[model samples]
Target: MGQRTLVVVPRPDGGFDCRYAHWGVTTDPFSGSRPLGRDWSGTAVCAELDAGYDRLLVAAARPRWYCVCWLDPTLTDPDDVVLARTDDPDRLRERWTEAKSRAVDAVARGTAPDAARAALLLGLARRADACHRADDASFLRDDG
Candidate 1:
Protein backbone atom coordinates (compact mmCIF):
# COMPACT_ATOMS: atom_id res chain seq x y z
CA MET A 1 0.00 0.00 0.00
CA GLY A 2 1.08 3.56 -0.62
CA GLN A 3 1.88 6.05 2.07
CA ARG A 4 -0.91 7.60 4.10
CA THR A 5 -1.12 11.11 5.50
CA LEU A 6 -3.23 12.32 8.38
CA VAL A 7 -3.94 16.01 8.92
CA VAL A 8 -5.14 17.39 12.23
CA VAL A 9 -6.54 20.82 12.86
CA PRO A 10 -7.66 22.57 16.01
CA ARG A 11 -11.27 22.69 17.09
CA PRO A 12 -12.98 25.43 19.08
CA ASP A 13 -12.95 23.46 22.30
CA GLY A 14 -9.13 23.60 22.44
CA GLY A 15 -8.87 19.98 21.38
CA PHE A 16 -8.04 18.80 17.85
CA ASP A 17 -9.78 17.03 14.97
CA CYS A 18 -8.13 14.79 12.39
CA ARG A 19 -8.73 13.39 8.93
CA TYR A 20 -6.69 11.05 6.82
CA ALA A 21 -6.14 10.31 3.18
CA HIS A 22 -5.17 6.88 1.96
CA TRP A 23 -5.67 4.70 -1.04
CA GLY A 24 -8.88 5.83 -2.76
CA VAL A 25 -10.47 7.06 0.45
CA THR A 26 -10.17 10.35 2.25
CA THR A 27 -11.59 11.50 5.53
CA ASP A 28 -12.30 14.90 4.01
CA PRO A 29 -16.04 14.47 4.04
CA PHE A 30 -16.60 17.76 2.30
CA SER A 31 -14.68 16.68 -0.79
CA GLY A 32 -17.56 14.61 -2.06
CA SER A 33 -21.27 13.96 -1.77
CA ARG A 34 -20.85 11.52 1.06
CA PRO A 35 -22.12 12.23 4.51
CA LEU A 36 -19.84 14.00 6.91
CA GLY A 37 -17.93 11.84 9.33
CA ARG A 38 -17.70 12.78 12.96
CA ASP A 39 -14.58 14.65 13.89
CA TRP A 40 -11.98 12.55 15.68
CA SER A 41 -10.42 14.03 18.76
CA GLY A 42 -6.66 14.25 18.45
CA THR A 43 -5.63 12.60 21.67
CA ALA A 44 -8.18 9.83 21.74
CA VAL A 45 -8.01 9.10 18.04
CA CYS A 46 -4.23 9.17 17.69
CA ALA A 47 -3.95 6.86 20.64
CA GLU A 48 -6.40 4.52 19.02
CA LEU A 49 -4.46 4.61 15.75
CA ASP A 50 -1.22 3.83 17.61
CA ALA A 51 0.29 7.06 16.30
CA GLY A 52 2.16 9.03 18.88
CA TYR A 53 0.23 11.92 20.39
CA ASP A 54 3.46 13.79 21.03
CA ARG A 55 3.36 14.98 17.47
CA LEU A 56 0.01 16.57 18.13
CA LEU A 57 1.51 18.28 21.13
CA VAL A 58 4.27 19.64 18.95
CA ALA A 59 1.75 21.02 16.52
CA ALA A 60 -0.14 22.60 19.38
CA ALA A 61 2.95 24.48 20.51
CA ARG A 62 2.57 26.84 17.59
CA PRO A 63 0.18 29.78 17.79
CA ARG A 64 -3.25 28.27 18.29
CA TRP A 65 -4.97 30.37 15.66
CA TYR A 66 -4.60 28.05 12.69
CA CYS A 67 -2.05 25.28 12.96
CA VAL A 68 -2.05 21.78 11.51
CA CYS A 69 -0.29 18.49 12.12
CA TRP A 70 0.86 16.34 9.24
CA LEU A 71 1.41 12.67 10.04
CA ASP A 72 3.13 10.73 7.32
CA PRO A 73 3.26 6.95 7.48
CA THR A 74 6.42 6.78 5.38
CA LEU A 75 8.53 8.46 8.04
CA THR A 76 10.34 6.45 10.66
CA ASP A 77 9.52 6.42 14.32
CA PRO A 78 9.82 9.75 16.18
CA ASP A 79 10.38 11.77 12.99
CA ASP A 80 7.17 11.47 11.06
CA VAL A 81 5.81 14.75 12.31
CA VAL A 82 5.37 18.11 10.61
CA LEU A 83 3.67 21.00 12.36
CA ALA A 84 2.49 23.79 10.13
CA ARG A 85 0.73 26.98 11.02
CA THR A 86 -1.23 27.68 7.88
CA ASP A 87 -2.27 31.26 8.51
CA ASP A 88 0.62 32.34 6.29
CA PRO A 89 1.31 30.42 3.14
CA ASP A 90 4.79 31.89 2.96
CA ARG A 91 5.76 30.06 6.13
CA LEU A 92 4.85 26.76 4.51
CA ARG A 93 6.94 27.58 1.46
CA GLU A 94 9.88 28.54 3.64
CA ARG A 95 9.59 25.30 5.60
CA TRP A 96 9.56 23.26 2.42
CA THR A 97 12.62 25.07 1.09
CA GLU A 98 14.49 24.61 4.34
CA ALA A 99 13.67 20.93 4.58
CA LYS A 100 14.74 20.30 0.99
CA SER A 101 18.01 22.09 1.68
CA ARG A 102 18.66 20.04 4.79
CA ALA A 103 17.99 16.80 2.98
CA VAL A 104 20.37 17.82 0.20
CA ASP A 105 23.03 18.91 2.64
CA ALA A 106 22.89 15.62 4.51
CA VAL A 107 23.47 13.75 1.28
CA ALA A 108 26.31 16.05 0.19
CA ARG A 109 28.12 15.78 3.50
CA GLY A 110 28.66 12.03 2.94
CA THR A 111 26.42 11.22 5.83
CA ALA A 112 23.92 8.45 5.42
CA PRO A 113 20.84 10.21 4.20
CA ASP A 114 17.95 9.77 6.59
CA ALA A 115 15.23 8.19 4.51
CA ALA A 116 12.50 8.99 7.00
CA ARG A 117 13.58 12.59 7.32
CA ALA A 118 13.80 12.96 3.57
CA ALA A 119 10.38 11.42 3.12
CA LEU A 120 8.82 13.69 5.70
CA LEU A 121 10.45 16.70 4.10
CA LEU A 122 9.15 15.73 0.69
CA GLY A 123 5.69 15.23 2.14
CA LEU A 124 5.75 18.69 3.64
CA ALA A 125 6.99 20.14 0.37
CA ARG A 126 4.17 18.50 -1.52
CA ARG A 127 1.61 19.79 0.97
CA ALA A 128 3.03 23.29 0.71
CA ASP A 129 2.96 23.12 -3.05
CA ALA A 130 -0.61 21.89 -3.03
CA CYS A 131 -1.73 24.71 -0.75
CA HIS A 132 -0.26 27.30 -3.08
CA ARG A 133 -1.75 25.65 -6.11
CA ALA A 134 -5.15 25.61 -4.48
CA ASP A 135 -4.87 29.29 -3.69
CA ASP A 136 -3.93 30.07 -7.28
CA ALA A 137 -6.74 27.99 -8.60
CA SER A 138 -9.24 29.69 -6.36
CA PHE A 139 -8.00 33.09 -7.42
CA LEU A 140 -8.25 32.18 -11.09
CA ARG A 141 -11.69 30.74 -10.65
CA ASP A 142 -12.89 33.86 -8.90
CA ASP A 143 -11.45 36.07 -11.59
CA GLY A 144 -13.13 34.08 -14.31
Candidate 2:
Protein backbone atom coordinates (compact mmCIF):
# COMPACT_ATOMS: atom_id res chain seq x y z
CA MET A 1 0.00 0.00 0.00
CA GLY A 2 1.11 3.58 -0.53
CA GLN A 3 2.01 5.88 2.35
CA ARG A 4 -0.47 8.28 3.92
CA THR A 5 -1.46 10.82 1.31
CA LEU A 6 -4.18 12.92 3.02
CA VAL A 7 -6.59 13.03 6.00
CA VAL A 8 -10.36 13.36 5.89
CA VAL A 9 -13.68 12.67 7.62
CA PRO A 10 -17.25 11.94 6.62
CA ARG A 11 -19.08 14.59 4.70
CA PRO A 12 -22.61 15.65 5.61
CA ASP A 13 -24.08 14.65 2.25
CA GLY A 14 -21.54 11.87 1.66
CA GLY A 15 -20.50 10.66 -1.83
CA PHE A 16 -16.71 10.29 -1.69
CA ASP A 17 -16.53 13.70 -0.10
CA CYS A 18 -13.64 15.59 -1.63
CA ARG A 19 -13.82 18.16 1.19
CA TYR A 20 -12.02 16.33 3.99
CA ALA A 21 -10.40 13.97 1.50
CA HIS A 22 -7.52 16.43 1.45
CA TRP A 23 -7.06 15.66 5.11
CA GLY A 24 -6.67 11.93 4.23
CA VAL A 25 -9.75 9.98 5.28
CA THR A 26 -11.96 8.52 2.52
CA THR A 27 -14.99 6.52 3.56
CA ASP A 28 -18.22 5.19 2.00
CA PRO A 29 -19.51 8.76 1.83
CA PHE A 30 -21.96 10.34 4.27
CA SER A 31 -24.89 8.29 2.94
CA GLY A 32 -22.77 5.17 3.61
CA SER A 33 -23.97 3.53 0.42
CA ARG A 34 -21.45 1.73 -1.79
CA PRO A 35 -21.25 3.49 -5.12
CA LEU A 36 -21.37 1.10 -8.06
CA GLY A 37 -17.94 0.14 -9.40
CA ARG A 38 -16.08 2.23 -6.87
CA ASP A 39 -12.34 1.51 -6.79
CA TRP A 40 -10.90 2.23 -3.34
CA SER A 41 -7.74 0.19 -3.68
CA GLY A 42 -4.80 1.86 -5.42
CA THR A 43 -6.53 5.22 -5.06
CA ALA A 44 -6.83 5.13 -1.28
CA VAL A 45 -5.62 8.36 0.32
CA CYS A 46 -4.37 7.57 3.80
CA ALA A 47 -3.73 10.61 6.00
CA GLU A 48 -3.17 14.25 5.26
CA LEU A 49 0.45 14.73 4.32
CA ASP A 50 2.29 16.24 7.34
CA ALA A 51 0.99 19.53 5.90
CA GLY A 52 -1.37 18.64 3.07
CA TYR A 53 1.28 18.57 0.36
CA ASP A 54 -0.61 16.00 -1.66
CA ARG A 55 -3.73 18.14 -1.61
CA LEU A 56 -1.79 21.04 -3.01
CA LEU A 57 -0.35 18.77 -5.66
CA VAL A 58 -3.79 17.54 -6.60
CA ALA A 59 -5.10 21.08 -6.86
CA ALA A 60 -2.14 22.24 -8.90
CA ALA A 61 -2.70 19.36 -11.25
CA ARG A 62 -6.01 21.04 -11.96
CA PRO A 63 -6.15 21.49 -15.74
CA ARG A 64 -8.17 24.70 -15.49
CA TRP A 65 -6.77 25.84 -12.15
CA TYR A 66 -3.78 27.85 -11.10
CA CYS A 67 -0.73 26.01 -9.77
CA VAL A 68 -0.30 27.38 -6.24
CA CYS A 69 2.27 25.60 -4.14
CA TRP A 70 2.39 28.17 -1.36
CA LEU A 71 -1.20 27.36 -0.41
CA ASP A 72 -0.27 23.69 -0.05
CA PRO A 73 2.53 22.56 2.21
CA THR A 74 5.54 20.46 1.17
CA LEU A 75 7.90 18.12 3.03
CA THR A 76 11.36 16.60 2.77
CA ASP A 77 10.17 13.15 1.65
CA PRO A 78 9.61 14.08 -2.02
CA ASP A 79 11.29 17.42 -1.45
CA ASP A 80 9.85 20.58 -3.06
CA VAL A 81 6.92 22.72 -4.04
CA VAL A 82 5.10 22.06 -7.30
CA LEU A 83 4.22 25.61 -8.33
CA ALA A 84 7.26 27.70 -7.52
CA ARG A 85 6.41 31.34 -7.97
CA THR A 86 8.70 34.17 -9.02
CA ASP A 87 8.91 37.82 -7.90
CA ASP A 88 9.02 39.06 -11.46
CA PRO A 89 5.44 39.69 -12.56
CA ASP A 90 6.39 39.44 -16.23
CA ARG A 91 8.14 36.10 -15.72
CA LEU A 92 5.27 34.73 -13.67
CA ARG A 93 2.76 35.78 -16.28
CA GLU A 94 4.78 34.10 -18.98
CA ARG A 95 4.98 30.90 -16.96
CA TRP A 96 1.23 30.90 -16.39
CA THR A 97 0.61 31.40 -20.08
CA GLU A 98 2.95 28.57 -20.92
CA ALA A 99 1.31 26.26 -18.40
CA LYS A 100 -2.17 26.99 -19.70
CA SER A 101 -0.94 26.40 -23.23
CA ARG A 102 0.61 23.07 -22.29
CA ALA A 103 -2.48 22.01 -20.39
CA VAL A 104 -4.59 22.85 -23.42
CA ASP A 105 -2.30 20.75 -25.58
CA ALA A 106 -2.55 17.83 -23.16
CA VAL A 107 -6.34 18.01 -23.09
CA ALA A 108 -6.50 18.34 -26.85
CA ARG A 109 -4.47 15.15 -27.13
CA GLY A 110 -6.74 13.47 -24.57
CA THR A 111 -4.05 12.50 -22.08
CA ALA A 112 -4.88 9.59 -19.82
CA PRO A 113 -5.83 10.23 -16.18
CA ASP A 114 -2.93 8.10 -14.90
CA ALA A 115 -0.50 9.97 -17.08
CA ALA A 116 -1.96 13.28 -15.96
CA ARG A 117 -1.66 12.25 -12.34
CA ALA A 118 1.95 11.24 -12.82
CA ALA A 119 2.72 14.47 -14.62
CA LEU A 120 1.30 16.56 -11.78
CA LEU A 121 3.10 14.56 -9.08
CA LEU A 122 6.39 14.62 -10.96
CA GLY A 123 6.04 18.28 -11.79
CA LEU A 124 5.59 19.19 -8.11
CA ALA A 125 8.44 16.93 -6.98
CA ARG A 126 10.83 18.55 -9.42
CA ARG A 127 9.73 22.03 -8.42
CA ALA A 128 9.82 21.37 -4.68
CA ASP A 129 12.90 23.47 -4.02
CA ALA A 130 11.70 26.34 -6.13
CA CYS A 131 8.35 26.32 -4.33
CA HIS A 132 10.12 26.78 -1.02
CA ARG A 133 12.30 29.61 -2.25
CA ALA A 134 9.14 31.42 -3.26
CA ASP A 135 7.80 30.85 0.25
CA ASP A 136 4.23 30.40 -0.94
CA ALA A 137 2.09 28.26 1.33
CA SER A 138 -1.53 27.75 0.37
CA PHE A 139 -4.27 25.11 0.27
CA LEU A 140 -7.36 24.66 -1.86
CA ARG A 141 -10.76 23.28 -0.86
CA ASP A 142 -13.12 21.73 -3.38
CA ASP A 143 -16.53 22.44 -1.86
CA GLY A 144 -18.20 20.81 -4.80
TM per candidate comes to 0.33, 0.27
What lDDT does candidate 2 reach at residue 37? 24
For model 1, state the Cα shift of residue 131 in Å: 18
Q: In model 2, where do residues sit more than 4 Å from their true spots?
A: 1-83, 120-129, 132-144
On the 0 to 100 scale, the lDDT of residue 94 in model 1 is: 52
Worst 10 residues of 1 by lDDT: 132-141
Error of 2 at 123 (Å): 4.6
Report the lDDT tens digits of candidate 1 across residue range 1-144.
432333344556745555454422223322522221345444444343322321111123242211133333323443244444244444554565466566656656664556635565457656542221111212111211
- Best-fitting candidate, scored by lDDT: 1
Q: Write the per-residue lDDT of candidate 2 for residues 33-71, one digit (tens) a residue.
A: 222222222123222223224332222222112233322
TM match of model 1 to true structure: 0.33
- Write down the lDDT that model 1 would get: 0.38
What lDDT score belongs to each candidate, Candidate 1 first?
0.38, 0.33
